[model samples]
Target: MLRVMTPTAVLLLAALPALAQPAHLQPTRDVSVTYRMNAPAAGGAPAAPQEMRMAFSVSEGKQRIDPPGNMGWMLIDRKANTAVMVMDAQRATMAMPPATVGAMTQGVPPGATFTRKGTATVAGLACTEWDVTAGQGRGTSCITEDGVLLRAVTTPPNGTPMTVMEATQVTYAPVEATRLTVPQGYSPMAMPGGAGTTPAR
Candidate 1:
């Protein structure tokens, strides 16, 4: 899976205190959000939503991605704004360069505003784009009338416009898991220091 350094990711990396839920929201939420990501072209035909499931977490202006089937973790740090990926699968471990996530959160700060860069066509849908060029992090997202974020693009210093990420078939509800708990038989592998984070945080 490709990594995307998004503003949502940056906010997570900041690890800001969790705020109160909106007045109308349910007291307890088992929110289940689906992100169907696609690159420009990945050789094979684009896959379906039923074949994909992903989670995006933004803490203190950082981004973290947890892919399906692999016990791997991808963390994007805010201040440094670089991406660090830790891959642990099938008894083997792999790590992505540390500079990746760091670039995403380079210059963005809380309450920083972005302007709509006018409508641009990404995958053939009308988009309301925005940007913050004063710093390294660039914000670009297209949302449907139903409030579904259909497409988004983020460019850190090391990343280019070519590294676009589009998410389709998004759904957000809630989950029942109270805390981050490892399975009984699964052992925690020694991941690269760059990307691993506290399970529950």
Candidate 2:
């Protein structure tokens, strides 16, 4: 005996695979992002935008954090574990702090994923709060109802209550600067992953 398939059943089966796949969130680009991380304060220093001009960018799904420092140009590609801490005409340090550096930086991880919990409007922009988890850790990334990370709540493994991570600022404008390109006479350092790389400065 041959079994018959219903059209309803057939369509549902065809859609199952696509439905199972995670949503694709296009990373933000060509924008300026100011990231601030404040710790349990007993005089802990809060993160500030490096005084040097910084432009955020993404390529092939990897995010790069670039800033010009008094020493030279500081470019950190957390995803790639690559860094360059330079000083003009001085010995360059190829030894970057490590992956602990990534515990900072802004925007979503190139490969992290999230699920929408619901919707809300803030500062007149409609937003969505999502429950997010990544290699970086577990957190909530709330995008504008329009679907971009506007706020995030990250929780530590030992159960530190979620710390708020808000986009706080954004604009869909192109960043202008002839070069995010590294200059000549600089050293390359591989950032070590894990606790070792958390930079004190």
Candidate 3:
């Protein structure tokens, strides 16, 4: 039997941390990016690549993500160090602190070292490449000067290339303020373990 994924799981998987950054790489303006992911097949014929569109609107240390295909969106408030997941189809929103979201989206796992390899360009943006190794796993990422991740490839020890994610399109423009907030009429859902709550707009 095939198992179906929860909306939360889909959101987490789709919400790859493409924009996680250090101080120098912080985005200076709002932007939209279209990403394509190619996953290696375990056996038989190759699988088709998956596509996702993401939008980031930045303001005062806060960033919001509008994911593709109505899977809903997420809001990350750096100042508050919190993240809000909005599920429109369910009309429910879940709030999480930075630590929780960090665990879900962190690229380099603990006890890993990252090294800058060189630089390259993607979707008209110049980026620096980094090599990361953690335990038996290894990966590479191409990040822009402003800290946007343009491409990533990862492999497990003794395993074939796992996945490749790349940005294919990028545009810089102002994101409407409304896009960053929860849409009206959604209900706040209590987080598992009773973490906290954020009322819907």
Candidate 4:
């Protein structure tokens, strides 16, 4: 005799495909988030945790991070898979090496897998937590429905999980296009150990 499927079972079957894919790491629309960065010392030694405010914004598929202090800013283009640093004082831009691009792009490492956990509230907004496993190690990321990363944690091989960054505030608004793009007529800067300017655009 053939078995019949219940309505709930049918609905769950239809949702399986969507669940297989990981949550969106970048914001789908214009939004800004201020995060408190907690970085561990080299070699995982115990040290005072320094807190700094990083202003992040995403618009039209491009992301920008205004680092703490007057260290300038960084621009990332997901489509082009490139990250560049814009030094306003020097009026120069420097392309980030390919090795570091993965970390800069929404904290999700390349070739990583995600398993959606229960939901949580961060920065006064609802988000879904995802347990991520990658070649490097395992971690978790809480992401908003609109695709903003509210908080992220990481664990190295044979190490404990540590909070890398967590959003302290979130704002949904329109970001000016110019803020995400390189300023007009800004020259490229030569990176250390290399000669010649990297194109920024």
* CA displacement after TM-score superposition, residue 189 of candidate 2 (Å): 4.9
Q: Sorted on lDDT, highest at the top, how do the candidates line up?
A: 3, 4, 2, 1
lDDT of 3 at 33: 72
Residue-wise C-alpha lDDT for candidate 2, range 1-201, written one tens digit per residue: 111111111111111111221242433454544433332333433444322233445542223233222444444454554443443345343334433333333345557665767876543456666666656556555454222444445575667654433333555555444344445545543334412222211
Q: What does the lDDT read for residue 133 in candidate 3?
A: 68
- Stretches off by above 4 angstroms in model 3 are 1-23, 40-46, 66-69, 104-111, 134-137, 191-196, 199-201
lDDT of 1 by residue, 1-201 (tens): 533333343232222111111121111222223444443334534444322233333223333455533445554444344544444344222333444333333333455555655665443444455454334445455543333343555564556553234544444443222222222333323343444433222
lDDT (Cα) of model 3: 0.61
- Which residue pairs in candidate 4 have backbone atoms (N, alpha carbon, C) closer than 3 angstroms, thus clashing? none
Local distance difference test scores for all models: 0.38, 0.40, 0.61, 0.61
Q: Go through the candidates in order and give the clash count of each.
A: 38, 6, 1, 0
Q: What is the C-alpha RMSD of each candidate to the true structure, in Å?
A: 8.8, 16.0, 4.5, 13.5
Q: What is the alpha-carbon lDDT for the whole of candidate 4?
A: 0.61
What lDDT would candidate 2 get against the real structure? Answer: 0.40
Q: For this target, which candidate reaches the highest TM-score against the unseen true structure?
A: 4
What TM-score does each of the candidates earn? 0.42, 0.48, 0.72, 0.73
Q: Is candidate 2 or candidate 3 better by TM-score?
A: 3
**Which wins on lDDT, candidate 2 or candidate 3?**
3
The segments of candidate 2 whose C-alpha lies over 4 angstroms from its true place after superposition are 1-24, 41-54, 58-62, 66-114, 121-125, 133-137, 144-148, 157-160, 189-201
lDDT of 3 at 56: 62
Q: Model 3: how far is 83 from its true place, Å? A: 1.4
